[model samples]
Target: MPRIVLATHNPHKVEEFQAIVAEVRPDLDVVAYDGPEPVEDGVTFAANALIKARAAAAHTGLPALADDSGIAVDVLGGSPGVFSAYWAGHKKDSAANLELLLDQLSDVADPHRTAQFVSVIALVRSDGTEETIEGRWPGRLAVQPAGPGGFGYDPIFVPDGQPADAERTVGEWSAAEKNASSHRSRAFVALAPLLESL
Candidate 1:
């Protein structure tokens, strides 16, 4: 299999992207990157993803894939869009971030609690060729976190289109189900064809 570097130290992102990419091109191998982390100072997911990918590709001289993802609340004016990981503070504490978000929305009505998970995936080659794609999963925030599956804001996110009687948060969904419909997966759906052409 052809090997490529993935520009992230996060195990969750490595696992998620590996699985999602494998679904499209199992012959490719998504390897971990060991380069220094880039400053994700970009204000948008696509910009950040590109920054990481470009840095990795420049550092390793290998095709690099990167992703920037976050949960954006409709009422928050897309706040925490790029700062989702550090929503509570600069610590990037998932639990604290989740807690702070929950508390901040404590007074928000259920109807106005709408939000979406956004993912932007970037790929850069040794020659500096690049492309980025995005995906969004529309959902609403639950009153409180629930279920034990998934990481980040999954516990508080209930996707739309669920049956009224069988509602479940992203945190409650099976890995297969989540992978099939996740924002990352959707983004990769657009990215996979580009990979094939490369």
Candidate 2:
């Protein structure tokens, strides 16, 4: 298998990315980076993804992949986009971030509760070549939290234009189901052809 370093220490992300790769490129292996965390000073998702990917490639001397993903709420003007992880503060607490966001949108009506998960995946080769691709899963926020499957704001986000039979929040979906339909999966799908060319 071809091993590619992923620029994150989060075990959940490591697992998710591995699962994503397994479906798209079973011959490829995804490994977590153990290098120092680079400052994600980028203003956009693609820039941030490249920032981390570059750091991982430089540190590990191998091809690296990174994604900058977040929940972009319409009423919030796509806020908590790049800052999703640290929305509440610098501690990166998901619960706190969710609560803070909910409080901010307490008055937001159902129509304006729209949001989408944005993922920008970037690949950085050791030779300095880099590329990025984006994927989005549009939806709206529910009035209350539901489900227990995914992390972040999954419990509160309802996918847009979903069938009545598919009304479950992202957190309610099984791992395999979420992997198949998630923004990250879409992003990986877009990147699959590129990886094959590599």
Best by lDDT: 1
Residue 98 of model 1 has an lDDT of 94
What C-alpha RMSD separates each model from the true structure?
0.8, 1.2
- Estimate, for each residue in 1-198, the C-alpha lDDT of model 1 and write its tens digit: 787899999998899888888899999989999999999999999999999999989888889999999999999999779999989989889999999999999999999999999999999976788899999999999998899999999999999999989989999998888999999999999888888754
For model 2, state the Cα shift of residue 92 in Å: 0.5
CA lDDT of each candidate? 0.92, 0.91
List clashing residue pairs in candidate 2: none
- List, residue by residue over 1-198, the lDDT tens digit for candidate 2: 678999998888889999999999999878889999999999999999999999999999989999999999987889999999999999999999999999999998888899999999999877788999999999998888899888999988898767877687888888898899889999999999878754
In candidate 1, stretches whose alpha carbon ends up further than 4 angstroms from where it belongs are none
- In terms of lDDT, the poorest run of 10 residues in model 1 is 189-198
